[model samples]
Target: MNTSPPTAIVRGATVRFGDVQALDGIDLALTRGALTVVTGPNGAGKSTLLEVIAGTTPLTRGTVDRDGAVAFVPQRTALTPRLPLTASDMVAVGTWRRAGLWRRLSERMRGDIAEAMERLAVLDLAHRPFAALSGGQQQRVLIAQGLVGRADLLLLDEPTTAVDARSAELILDAVAAETARGATVACVSHDPRLIDTAAVVVPLDGGRIDQSIRDAGRGRPRCPA
Candidate 1:
């Protein structure tokens, strides 16, 4: 079994938005260097779970312990046509965490950004206005932005939604590569293509984890307690 320590752990996690409970006590451990796919119906708290792990949303109750830097690629981003930002410019934002504002990007950082864009197949769209790109193209660019950081933990929400078949394939390939490189990846998706390949599949319902299926046949163990 893959007995390595978990990359992140969430215990007794509960999130309430007024009268609505987004998550009911959830205990989860994300295995390091594995692809974890969170699947559920709409409003099943898939995105909320990811947000909790990303530390962007505070839990109403519970605790989360995580390791290393994180890179989150949200499902959708709205950019006005007037923004005048190019695709490359959007991807370069990933480097800001390390390079910071007003600091020139080092050669390695620049190369990382370029490599990320190329892996997502958006390198050719580098000079195009971000707002001018198609939905699939924009999605790929956002993913590239996330990848450029080379964060230890990568989280994505519905990355393949509304994307073309080729784009979806490319996105999946890129995330899989991240896992191969020992980065922990958690993706919220309904796409069977992703679930079928995930080392761990987590299904949620009514804001609770229904089950965690680790591909034991492949020698992967269940989420740690």
Candidate 2:
């Protein structure tokens, strides 16, 4: 790790959507180079937490502050089903920060995209239309997209929900590599098996985090709860 401070900080965070209290008094500190897995059942506010960290969700109370750039790959991307973009094209969008919206890609950028696709085992699907891919394939491609360019904070929601065992391993391996390289990677998943690899296993229930488990991961890591 580069000795950077927490990549993201959430203090007494709360989010309300209509009648739903998505989050309640959440305090989280996402440290750099840690792979934190946020686990919970459906409606446990996992997705909302990711959005809040990414700065896309409006909080009803509390605060979320980031130390650097953030990249979020929602469990389901909002890309229209009819868009005629290829899987590779979708992943390349990660490099848009450097390759302007309408600009061309240089050799270096192309290499980065290729490497990211390969990491997720989606390099062979480069020519396939994104919408035409299976659910698992689409999920892998979306993950590759979030990794195309290095972001200080990388957020993923249920990244392996639809993938098979092999693909899930690849995705987790890639996420682990990102944390090893100094990115704060926060993943939301319901699979408890993931705890075996996570630096921090944060279990959410009733819109509140289990601080006992969370505090253990403050500096010393342990297996999932």
Candidate 3:
């Protein structure tokens, strides 16, 4: 049994937008150094669950308690072609959480950014315009942004979707490496490869949890739904 405290805990979480309920009574705990995959059909509230954990979405009821820094990478980002931001610039956004907007990045921060891009196999794309990159390249760059901070809690939505096999492999390996380095990783993905390797699998439907499955070979026991 891994006795370390959970990185984050969501208790009795619920979210409602007018007549639509996005999440209902979700109770979950994200284990340190473990990967938890959230899977479900469209409108299953999977993304909403991540938002709640990221503290970007407010709950209609219940509470969330979390520790350390959090990095959230959404499924899609809108970057204007007119902005002229390079791939390296996009990855550098991850450092802003700790470095703030105005402070110049230290040498170590720059190194970390470079390391993250390399891990995602996007180091070569660093000088290219972010908006000009292909879908796979853009996704890889965005994930590198999430990794540059070495956040305690890393949240990603559908990271491998619509990407080439090589890109998908790089993304999966990078995510796995984060957990290996003791980050709590929760990702929303339909990829069977991710699901098979996840420490915990969370299935949500109609704004409620169907169940929580902890792989017999990974992490701790199953969390109560």
Candidate 4:
């Protein structure tokens, strides 16, 4: 069994928006190279959990420790429409945090962008305008962007939404590939089938984890749900 501590840890997390509790006393551990699927009914705080993991939302009452760089793909596409950038350009943005304005990208950085596109099978579309692709293609491009910096933690919110079944499968396959390469992934989705590909399954209800299942193939047996 892999004995390493989790790459990301959430302990007694809680979030509230007025009277409604978005998240309540949630605790989770995402191990390195592990794929964890977050599934539950609507209004279950799945998205809120991903947001906290990515550092987009501050915790209301507890703690989240994200040890390495993190990446996020929101449920809605966040591409800049007026930027007139290509798909490759979008991928390059991942590195901008390291080389902000007034900095030039090194050849090595450029190579990483190229490799990311190729890994997602979007190399041919590298030169395509970001706004010219369909929903699924755009999703893949965003994923490539997220991976450009070798982000250790990736949080995807409903990545398969609006895409065809085949496209969704492609994205899931790529996610599996990322996890195999030592990136921890937490994906929020309404689809329960994704549980099959995950090392752990977390089910949310009314803002808290209702059940947790650790896949038996890699880790010690978890208490029955």
Candidate 5:
């Protein structure tokens, strides 16, 4: 067991959009450096849970204690295809916080972007316009972008959607790389292969987690209250 502190903890968290409750008192502890897969049926609020973990959505009730920077890759539909930026340019956006305007990318920044793209197997698409790529390709680029940033918490919503087996493996490898670097990875997924890589499996239904399976290899995980 790593025995390190968790990356985030949700206690009685609730998120309501109109009458539909996206997250209904959801509670889960995202273990540091461990990959957690969020599984649920359609309209089960899997996306909403990721948003809450990313801190992009305000909770309607209860609390979320998050520790450290976050990187989020939303669903493909959330990615804007209208941008004229190339795939690399889109990935470089993750480094913009440090590169900023007028500041040329340092060697480290350039390497980070390259490594992220390479891990996602999208390096060849670096010069291609994001909008011109296929949906699977665009998803890979978005994942590359998310992985390039300095985030302790990685929240990816259905990262493997439309991705081929090889591409999906590459993405999983990238997520593994992030975990090896001590980041907590949380992904919303329906893919069964990912279950083997996860330290915790949370299954949601109608906006609430019905059960959570802690990986036996990690011993028993203590989710803080």
Candidate 6:
């Protein structure tokens, strides 16, 4: 394992959307190589947390400090249709921030693209048109793209949405594998079972995280109130 300390911190965080308080007083610590799953019912501020961490939305309160680059996979796959781009091309976009705006990819960049695709089991899809894939396939491709950066932190919002159990398991297993490799993963899911693999399970209700305890084997990680 990397043995590095936490690379991301979400402390006393809160967010408001007009009349709705998306998040309320949330404190979270994501250490390197830990997979933390945030589980809650609908309207529990899952996506909001991811957005705040990714810097797409401003924090209404508190702080989220990411020590290194963070990769985010939104609930909706950000695949562009009719663009004639392959899955490999989409993954390559993840490296864009590392290069100057006008700079082209070097041989090393291309190698990274291939490696990321292979890592996520999407190498066979590398030449396939991204838009032509099914929902599950697209989800996997997006995950592959997100991993291309080898980011210190990865935030996924409902990553298993619309996928079958087999596909979902594959995604979750891959996420766990990444954690073992020393990357911090913060994922949100409405499914309680998702928390089974999480080192930390945070349940939120009414915009506040519920006081909960972790019990991995029971399939119910939340404490009985």
Pairs that clash in candidate 4: none
Clashes of each: 0, 0, 0, 0, 0, 0
Best by TM-score: 3
**TM-score ranking of the models:** 3, 1, 5, 2, 4, 6
lDDT of 2 by residue, 149-225 (tens): 79999999988886788888888888888988899999998666666667677788778885545444346343222
Q: Residue by residue across 66-92, what tens digits does model 4's lDDT show?
A: 888898888655546556888888888
Q: State the local distance difference test value for candidate 5.
A: 0.85
Off by over 4 Å in 4: 77-83, 212-225
* Candidate 3: Cα lDDT at 59: 93
lDDT of each: 0.87, 0.84, 0.89, 0.80, 0.85, 0.77
What alpha-carbon RMSD in Å does predicted model 6 have with respect to the real structure? Answer: 3.5
Tell me, what's the RMSD of every candidate?
A: 2.5, 3.2, 2.4, 3.1, 2.7, 3.5
lDDT (Cα, tens digit) per residue for candidate 1, span 1-225: 456788899999999999999999999888889888898889999999999999999999999999988898877753454557999999998888889977998899889988999999999999999888999999999999999988989999999999999999999999889999999999999898888778778788899877654454755333444
The best candidate in terms of lDDT: 3
Q: Please estimate how well model 1 matches the true structure, expressed as its whole-model Cα lDDT.
A: 0.87
Off by over 4 Å in 2: 1-4, 77-79, 211-225
Error of 6 at 105 (Å): 1.5
Ranking by lDDT: 3, 1, 5, 2, 4, 6
TM-score of 4: 0.87
How far in Å is the alpha carbon of 136 misplaced in model 4? 0.6
Off by over 4 Å in 3: 77-83, 212-225
> Which residue runs does candidate 1 get wrong by more than 4 Å?
77-83, 211-225
In model 2, what are the clashing residue pairs, if there are any? none
Clashing pairs in 1: none
- Distance from true position, residue 160, model 1, in Å? 0.9
